[model samples]
Target chain A: MVEVQALSKSYVGRTVLDGVSLSAPQGAIFGVIGPRGAGKTTLLKILATLVAPTAGDAFVAGASVVSEPLRVRRQVGYLPNDFGVYPDQTCAEYVEFFAACYGVPARERAALAADLLQLVDLYHRKDTPADRLTPAMRYRLGIARVLAHDPRVLLLDELTAGLDPRARVEARELLKELSSMGKTILLTAPNLAEVQDLCTHAAILHAGQITQAGPFDEVLATTPPYRTIAVKFLGDVRLAMNLIKAANGVVDVQPFNEPASPSDALAGVTLLKELRVTFDGAYADASVLLRSLMHSGVQVVSFAEEN
Target chain B: MRAPHLKLPALELSPIFAKEMAGRMRSARAYMVLTVYLAIVSGLSVLLYMVSFLGSPRTVSGSGAVGTVVFYFLVGMQVLLASFVAPAFTAGAISLERENKTFDVLRVTLLTPAQIVWAKLISALGFTLLLLFATLPLFSLAFLLGGVEPRELIIALCVVFASALMYALLALYISARSRTTVGATLSTYAIVLGVVIGIPLAALIGSSTVSLALAPTSGSSSPLADLFDTLLTLAISLSPISAIAASQRFFSATGELWTFTPSFTGSGLALTLPSPFLILTGVYLIASVILYMLTVRRVARIEQQ
Candidate 1:
């Protein structure tokens, strides 16, 4: 329900988002992951119709962000990274106020606000002032406010940043529930790991460019099919390496070392050099290599995935 | 075939207007501000009553000169105070949205730019009117005392409201331009100073210089002098204080609230123009509409890019 084409943004003399493009299909939980200053927020703002791109355009729910911002706004709900609560306004009042802004009839706002508050699990805090709610609760109320108009697409910037682990999990679950309801969600995060478990599709941005963009599994699976296995050998490292090189699916082997301790060197200790094997295979082939190393009488101290 | 455009239904009260009114009414600060405003006006009225009537019994005639003095003083204060209060209420209207990061949310709403502007204007003006109405008894004292007429009271009210709107729109315009609440408030006060104090002073200086320079030759009859005097009068009329003073002067001279025809024959453009109250009201309302449109344009630009 959201599509961006070669979107670029610049502020003064500095370029923030450079020719970035991505799309989110209907009901998909798409995430944009990048470090700070990677233009993630800028990209999201452009799609949200809050910021205009210097070049290119974005469309949400068939509305061009540049030409039909009001229409885009009608179909999309944007929760900015720094979303704040109005002081002295209760949760229900805040949601009702937004519902009113979206032109929800006065008679319907109460029930709508109630339903939205329930969706965000903030029904209990309905009467509480928005500022009195905890940060996570306030964030949830912001979500509830955005959904007050029942938008089809949600453009959230840093939707989970600064949340406690439990709140984060709850927010993820709520997003999942909403996505299941066919609300297309596009969000930005600081790291892939933050959204890896929740997002079906994600784009990794670096230095204002999309470095990698695809389905989660597809992107992760395309990372060279190379696994570095670190093995600590106590004796006959050469034989172990030679046998691993001859093993099935073994691509390459190299000796790796952890920096030696001065105390160990001074104590005449002969530290075992680490062996790193580049293996391209499934679990069965890795098991076979381990068995062969064991049968070869090579004493192995440790074995682990390098990364 | 061209598709027909469908417009959204306009709400009688904007959601922003309702929200602002609700927020303002709920805050203790609003009540405290009102209390302080009432207290000051009450104190001034009582002091003026005592000084005008009690200090001199001979001046207490059936003519109610004391009432006139008190009325003028109270209306002057109302105009001046509303100027300050209106800006204080509205200068931060938009900038506070930016501070709280809600401007984008507001823009994306179905509320049109004009509706948002009206919301800010109406809410601020509503509070200002509330404060003005709270002093109704004091205003009634002027009428009860007999120098102030119902007609003059109504005219004074119209002028007060128009000036309040002018100041509020000024602040909203500044608010739309500023990124911070403090910056907008400060800038609004600066503009307020220019309109309330600076403009009248400049007009006085300009007119006096023109009069003094021509004093030796023409003594206020030359066309150049007439033109300068007319321009100065009109410029001075732009300030509410000057407008109220001129209105009071006209009321005292003609014993009428408004005079559409010139009371005296003169060869100056100023003499043919409308009363200062009418002129100032028209100028302020027109300027306010222009500024409101400019604010809406700025907001639309922000939304588009």
Candidate 2:
């Protein structure tokens, strides 16, 4: 579980994060989506207790990241997007070192290292130096490092930003596996499509504020869901508009008006004037309305959705 | 609250110190540095002994003389070594956390700022001391001539010990302040070298001018003369070479126990300066401690707000 209240951070004269508040419950997959410079990384750093916020408070897994950072750290595992490895250290050695730093005992570190490596699918690369690994391998090892201590919550900053398509898919799939284990995952990224199907919940951050957040479908539903269809009437325009208005999903209609056209040309000129219409439900509504209008009396020319 | 299965009472400091040592040990550069240091101490001792041998029967300035040269070489080596290694060690000790983007991970661990600072110091100094120990055989070669006084040896060890600690702490402070190892290393070397090198040069040059100006005066101690004597004595102890030389001169004359007090017999020893070295050591030590505390505070503040 995580809670942030009025969290703000600034460097010099510029504000990076301004009064951003958020909360994630146990086992919830919370996603923070934003464009560049939206303070997504800054917010994650504060939550991970790596960087301090200039003002406000945060708690991670019942421990205050501001006041009880050590406790919070023990409870949370953070995988920074750019967290790197010592080139000379083997994957196993790297994980072992972190385990030691996290206060895992000497006796338990070896096996724990193996287990974590296995979890990240880097078990075969256990003896391989960390720097020699590919970008995807490096990211997987970074994840292994975070899970070495079996933390309660995971804060993944840009978990799939720079990876190629295949690696990105792998990361997403790995996250899905961890989430199934009831891990409270809080991840940040800009690719909505990648996370759209993967994340159960997401927050859209624009200009350093949580503009909209919740289930992606719920947020999309909150916005006006309408299918806009463009139609060129081959026959009488007035007659076509009347027929479309009578269909099941024909909510609204606006006639296409040309600039600097004579009144007579604009009137009764159904060959070129395109009539746009809106429909609720699937895109089939627009097609169904268009066919019904054509079947009645008006000759339909061309019709397409407003992509 | 307890950390499960922690055997080391100072386990918080253990990981940092061990990793510090491991990193340095695995580097060819670290070995190269140690080799250079060993060569300098051995070569300097040989050079100094040759010079002393050429100076007459008085060249055998007794056992204390041996201690003098040993510590003189050690002082120079410690300064050079501290400049080189302290920067590398302390600079990366904290800044590299930022470099690897693991600063957050380290900060979030169940280790407080004080623990982090202490671990950093141990990490830096522990490795430095290991290299120093590796060259102790060369040090003992100076002791072989047998004129070194036990008290002088004790004082030398104490000064080197305190000096190493102070240097380590100072570098850690600089490391904490900077975000990169390069910046921290350069700043640490400059600041520490300035403190350790600057003060002694000022004292030596200042005292020499005063001594030359007062050379015409006779045997009586003017009030001002006594003050200069006290200041000069303090300066000698503050300095590694001067302290060794003064102690050597004192032992070559009267075999009295060395303490902070003075036996104002100028017939045996020309002067006393260990007290001043001790003063400077105290000042530097205090400064180092204050700097380390400030570093810890900076880290804690970064974590808090």
- The candidate maximizing TM-score is 1
lDDT of 1 by residue, B1-305 (tens): 11112234464477777788888898799899889988998898878887888655654474387888788888888888778988898999999988987788788787878888888889988988898888877887887777777777766777888889989999999999998989999998988889888988888888778788877664645666766666676777788887777677777787766543342226433344677788888888899899999999888775332
Q: Provide DockQ values for all models, in the order shown.
A: 0.19, 0.20
Q: Write the per-residue lDDT of candidate 1 for residues A95-137, one digit (tens) a residue.
A: 8888888777777778888888888988998999898987789
Instruction: Report the TM-score of candidate 1, chain B only.
Output: 0.86
Q: Highest DockQ, which number?
A: 2
How accurate locally, in lDDT, is each candidate? 0.80, 0.72
Tens digits of per-residue lDDT for model 2, A186-226 = 99865354366677777766667776767767655553445
Worst 10 residues of 2 chain B by lDDT: B1-10
DockQ of 2: 0.20
Give the Å shift of residue A83 in candidate 2.
Answer: 1.4
Q: TM-score each candidate.
A: 0.80, 0.76
